[model samples]
Target: MVTGKMFDMTTPAALLADDTAYAEAVETAVKAAAAYYATGESALDDEAYDRLARAITAYEAEHPERVLPGSPSGKVAGGAAQGDVPHTVAMLSLDNVFSPEEFTTWAASVERRIGRPVAGWSVEPKLDGLAVAARYVDGRLARLITRGDGRAGEDVSHAIGTIVGLPEKLGEPATLEVRGEVLMTTDQFERANTVRTAHGGAPFVNPRNGAAGSLRAKDRPYTVEMTFFCYGALPLPDTAAELADALGESTHSEVLDRVAGLGVHTAADTAVPPRTASGAAEVLERVAEIAGLRAELPFGIDGVVIKADSAADQRDAGSGTRAPRWAIAFKLPAVEKVTTLVSVEWNVGRTGIIAPRAVLEPVRIDGSTVTYATLHNPADITGRDLRIGDHVMVYKAGDVIPRVEAPVAHLRTGAEQPIVFPEVCPQCGSEIDTSEQRWRCVRGRDCRVVASISYAVGRDQLDIEGLGTTRVVQLVDAGLAGDVADLFTLTREQLLSLDRMGETSTDNLLAAIDAAKRQPLARVLAALGVRGTGRSMSRRIARHFATMDRLRAADAAAIEQVEGIGTGKAPVIVEELAELAPLIDKLTVAGVNMTEPGATPPPAEGEEPAPSDAGGPLAGQTVVVTGAMTGSLEKLSRNQVNELVERAGGKSSSSVSKRTALVVAGEKAGSKRAKAEELGIPLMTPAEFAALVADFLDEE
Candidate 1:
């Protein structure tokens, strides 16, 4: 077990004075580093480890004559890892600065050491993964070596064929060593875990751990893919003298470009590529820019690296025993934290999917106190080897929900208990369907009547003002309602008999329920909570068929003609609507509206077809709206804008794809807007979209 007492004892004099405490602190740090470097699993998170190491460094600086041999100060991998294979050039670590003030101080020091202003700065994301040296001989990938220590590394050539971006052959015939990081992208990590578990292996806790373990493994039944991104390149001792001279003379930016040209991946291939910053200010700006885009990046980054771009400047600044004097890492806040798994909760969703949720020990991560995280499914819990009372890594990025990455098995004390999954539905005590990865109640939405009914009364659905989840549960428990259709049959006397139901509240609720009968067929379909349809999809379906009777008559083939409804989903929708026939009949008898306004119904058999509105600007177009609207659209909600699109004879979509006809990009448009541009889809500003849809705006 690793102790974090040193994190609290930050004072150098206080730690140096206590001999026993100081020694314990050193031992704790050494063990943490060893675990982190060897398997990418540590008892402490990155921020905690950094703080403890900084304290040790401060104490050592004051008592240089009494420094311990196991001290982590001025050491690569904290002097905990070593190997026999010597690196062509020392794979030195970068000294870190946590803030802009510290970065500015480091930059000033580098300028003073060089005796002149630096030529330029190269700023790039500091990838969070295992550092390695990839050697090439005669343009062929020859070996892969991990950065065991600064001077030497362990050979991991077994991973050569499995790594993407690091090609088997270079674009040109050359003998050199390229230094880069080997990591699993977000998508790769999930796939690796799935493949690993299928092969009867324990799932890796995180991407970094997966990469480290996969890189060194041999003779495994499964191969997990990883990605490589070169940050620097150097000439080997056997390299041509002319090439060595050119490599030594080239600037960092130029060398990276050449690396990318040689079929080796670099930061140049990413969205936030290395930029040449004129000074410290620009470098800091680049750092912030990269940090802002961290959540959106495919791979993980712990910090941003800033280095002197000019080779001459790097030579003048010189190197330290563990790091370079000319480069510094601007560290970002840690997005992952190690916390205890207190317990697991099984929740029945509206559709009866029994999801497992991890209850954590309230650890602070990425500026929030995360007490709960998503566990995905029961299979995930088993594959990850997670247990109650075990230490687990909790990861949160930007607006995404927190998730339990994996259990830190090394930190288990044997007291941890296995997480038990339910054989029956947790909410209704019914048999669960476990054929799929996600367990579900055999009764589907009926198993959770309260939640399903509450959704039906939501603002965008039936618009019943007084009915919420609590009221729905009360009504269900009192036997006054069993489903959305039963809600319309609730009588005044039955509602008045409830404990909290006053005369005023009951009358208001009754009026709301009566008003709901006139809602459009689209809203009524949305209230049904079909498995494969949502609000927008319901609008598309209702508009296509025009009436409930026609919609009930549609087969999978007819449903497939609706916008965004594919072959697979069309069948599912048709099946669900068929099962909901009894509920639809009840609602129809209760006088709920079954027709959509402004929708053109399909022609009857042997009937003449209506003329097409070919002159309409968006007659055959599929349009998507993204980001915050402005101008005339400022007062309109997203659903209202979608309504306007349909009124103008366009099919509105929530995602951008190759089939997308146009995109209305508003202010602060993010990935969807970017995807539209990438696909070469037509784009319009919000003002331009507003002008085009002016004739249909009032139709809402």
Candidate 2:
């Protein structure tokens, strides 16, 4: 057992100073852990909870008679008592071992209990997701229940049908209760958050939290995609070996195969090579291999579960009051750490949403020095009770963006000040709108012109070459361009007046603006910066309506016919299109293309159709272009390079992965060049890229 400072005790030496105080602290810790485990979101991290649990265990060991009845040490971690339905069998939490030595010690204890050396062990990644028990009766999914309090769980049968990787009907008729994790992939999490942000809701902190919250969302429709991975089964097998036998399989690995055959998803790739080892060193090596691959895994994994592979050994080893004695979860070191909250910075996004970011006293976590973390919104900041100068717990959610979990209240001083959300926009002094969870500038287009224009000139939109953020800001500040359409009307003299606008630079800018007028209708629609309309949506809408006139004439019902344009978003699209009519008219008057090129009506009978650029020189290749280029490509922006790649019938990727067949590296080329060299991918200079495009055009 471990000893630490008591909850109310100021010093470690004073932990056992008062018996009553220690007892109260233990009780409080137990309650907090229970609540957190039940809800899947916690004020304290796993490490903190472990410390508190260890403290209570140490107290109980010294004074066994005074052990609290509801202590976390004596029972499985608590879960939601109420759910959609009750679990058929109790879903108990596993005992966690932090170190390989601790794991070895546990394995020895299991061997001692069984009165024999263990044959082998089965190891698998411990996914960080919501625990759910899915029951199948007569080859059909009957019910789904959340792991609530190791006893009764919530019924989520309604969401069972929507769950990916979970078959509604099994391959064969059988009454089996499959226990697994319900989780959202990284891409799914991002998409869900994007949609949620557009719909005026706060994005979930992490995928695990997102999955748990989305699964239990009562008010909203169940549109969020979630995946399930089966890890266990009922009739309550004593061990993985017994589970295999129960399923009429040979090895623990085979049990997973059988589960997959039943149309239930399992992490078989990671769970392979069930090795038999007489010594702890061999088992430790296997565990280490699994831990090393955690970063590359699609889903989040906090640890690895090592289970005794023999059914007899597990049976003889028996079970603890809470967890199985034959199995132990070797928890990975936490990616979170305590850091001082220096201050909070609010940033205005393209949509006018004011997002709060936490500036932290630099701390290293998961191989990266994290100096900043997202506070999400004002409500999240206040709810977490975060304040400047407070020591706070920070972690990288999904191993990507850093997030402030909560403030360390015990480490706080009176100097800590509350973060006040601003009443007005920092950029334009516009009144802030707090109607939604995320506060936004009320003066939408008038004040947020910089963001709108920047997005409009983005790679996926108009593919404007020289209209970068700095130029856009200068243009907006000088009142030369109020909207995206205004860019086309600027004269060479107006551009030359801006700072650093030389003769060649002015000419290049003019040429780029002139070229943007010929962009396809889909790109033009995307460039318009319509609410909830992205590249794909714009393409779909343009394809359906064919021309800008038809799209402008489209009502909500007609817009709703387009795929992904639901009832909620259709009206917004129609309203935004109507609002953008003036801008459209301005662009039309300036000779911007209203119809998609090459989409003209077919030629008359006896007349051959014009040749298409579908089979261009660079066709069927994946190219990744990086760094600033020289020569003809010098004036071409990153978006322009990508546009060139697309026009040549090749896909332009942002990263140089194994799928990248060619990499166009320019001056001051960085990591991408190094990676390409290492991978032996074909490399090209800016001049070479220009030549390649010229060749493609010559072929056309």
Candidate 3:
């Protein structure tokens, strides 16, 4: 229902008279985006280019005959997610402009065609955040994908359910992927650093990086401090304002006002009049002014986004290699300065991959001091031809870890030499190995590190109150304890004999060790010197067997049979479990609690069991766990039941299914329970359905 005076692109036939020509235009746009991304120069700013891309897609959607080869509309990039979700589109990146001068040139070009200067413009601050595609189905969020390598990104829909600022369902029933940026709140970024400081881990460098990295960690736990907003909708919305109105869930800047109503954030600053008006110069002026004020914004801003407010004009402008002619992002200049590369050092990771690091003359950048930065790997040294004494340029990607962006090679003298990776592990003196992706230490199995007592005392584990990494290392080197088990063997006399262990501290340390003995098998599994088996996976492995004895006895096939375990991992798991059997038995005799009891079975059938204060809610409710239960991922069956009880307000019964309240949970689910849970709720346990139920129940 939207149109413009000068351009007519409402219908597919109107946009391109020839079907072949339309297909070529689509191909041209996809290729242009790929080529521009390949080169340093971008074809269009992200928003503009995306609009054009959407228009091309709209054309194709209207006329199947216009569908072309390599049409972005035909194929969607698959998102790689640890959970069950999949992405319908591969979100692509926009070529960015870095200065106000670039913005002026772009606006002028538009004006030359429009035959008039732009009218009054509106301006909004540019926000620095992660680019993503959030897909919705039936008005509910379906999937979220990152812009990976331009083809496919890792799927992160599960994280979406937990991400606080996004809505699980929109105002209307619509199936589309709303693309935008996800960001860390200002307060979160500041508080994150404080917590990071409390631990030995370095604080997150910036909000954007924190948001991006959190979505991809796949294993590390993340928080709900992230937020998202949509500026544009795709496949093209029924109308632009309608979509913008959906974004109005957040704000009311005319353009953003509509977008906010659509439940998206509007970063529209200075909405200049149509591309045909005289206000064009004003648009350029305001964008330039923002370049100066951007750094002062409460959150992060990478660039200003300028887009055509009219949906029809956007279709007319269409798309080129990587962007649309209707919109452009003017990026702020890089915060670059000179600093000395004090020294080069090589560090070995747990994997035994040796990489070079640059120690620098401490300098501040974007607000923080720059003392050191990662060089990525030794190949970077030889490729960049870096020298230790030469000055280097360091860059932080949206405030994340600062990396040696590139060397100021011109400052280097003839003294530069190629850096080398260490041939062996420094700690264990084992040979090094290499992968297609990374260099690895060939020390213990999976290059396993001897569990540093530091981990043993971590909050989730032993939690020895006062012990820290520095002290743990000291204790280990002094031979006070050899492994997690040896901690208990220490007495007051033994501890006081060490560097700083006082009489009172010794008692506390002993208490912690005693407490760790009672930790469950899953924690012990995580604590043991195993490769790739973290706490989450450990719980998963524990659920496969009734007791530590059973697990230690399991073969790879038995282990792999457990959901989530794949063939590639079978051997590694089998070998480790067998190797650790002796140690597990020793600890068992040492009075360590191994496996925790499985979920209390649902109350027996027809038995008048006492009404306990805290009986299992899901008890006696027949349930089936399926693809990616957000809860209890490790305990496949118990997890499914947990979902039924905790998420769906249903229960679990061991023997009854047809009579059960719900048999909910996803793929790989047997037909027996599906038929039962399917009765009224038809409880299909797909991770998605469970999530949908969860969203609804949460409202109560």
Q: Top model by TM-score, which number? A: 1
Which of the two candidates, 1 or 2, achieves a greater TM-score against the reference?
Answer: 1
Q: Which ten residues in a row have the lowest lDDT in candidate 3?
A: 1-10
* Models sorted by TM-score, best on top: 1, 2, 3
Candidate 1 residue runs with Cα over 4 Å from true position = 1-17, 238-246, 470-480, 487-522, 532-575, 588-693
User: C-alpha displacement of 507 in model 2, angstroms?
Assistant: 2.8
Candidate 2 per-residue C-alpha lDDT over 1-700 given as tens digits, one digit per residue, 9 for 90 to 100:
1111101111122244456866776666766665454544555566566666666677777888876666667676632244445555557778877666577688888888888888778777788888888877767888788877667777777786768878999888766778888988777877776666556665555666678777877677336888898876654333245443565434455566777887888876332223444567776665555554455456777777888776666667777667788888877655666778998898887767788999999986665689999888997776566788987777663256888866666556699988877878987898998986878788766667888899888877877888899999999999999988899999989999999999899999889888889888878988887877876567657656768987787789878888679998999898778867888999999999998643333333488965554576677788989878898777666755776776676777766667798999998665567557646799999888888788543322
Q: Give one digit per residue, the lDDT tens place, for model 1 in 84-197.
A: 899878898888877776778889999999999999999998998999999999899998899889899998988889999999999999999999999999999999998988
> Of models 2 and 3, which has the larger TM-score?
2
lDDT of 1: 0.87
Model 3: runs farther than 4 Å from truth? 1-38, 41-304, 311-344, 349-416, 428-451, 470-474, 499-502, 544-546, 555-585, 599-700
Best by lDDT: 1
Candidate 2 wrongly placed segments (more than 4 Å): 1-31, 37-43, 51-93, 97-230, 234-250, 253-326, 330-348, 351-396, 399-443, 458-460, 463-468, 539-546, 598-700
Could you give candidate 3's per-residue lDDT for residues 242-347 as a string of tens digits? 5545543322234444434556554432122112122555555555445434333456665667765555445445555445566676545344335777788766
> Per the 3 Å backbone cut-off, how many clashing residue pairs does candidate 2 have?
7
Please give each candidate's TM-score.
0.84, 0.57, 0.42
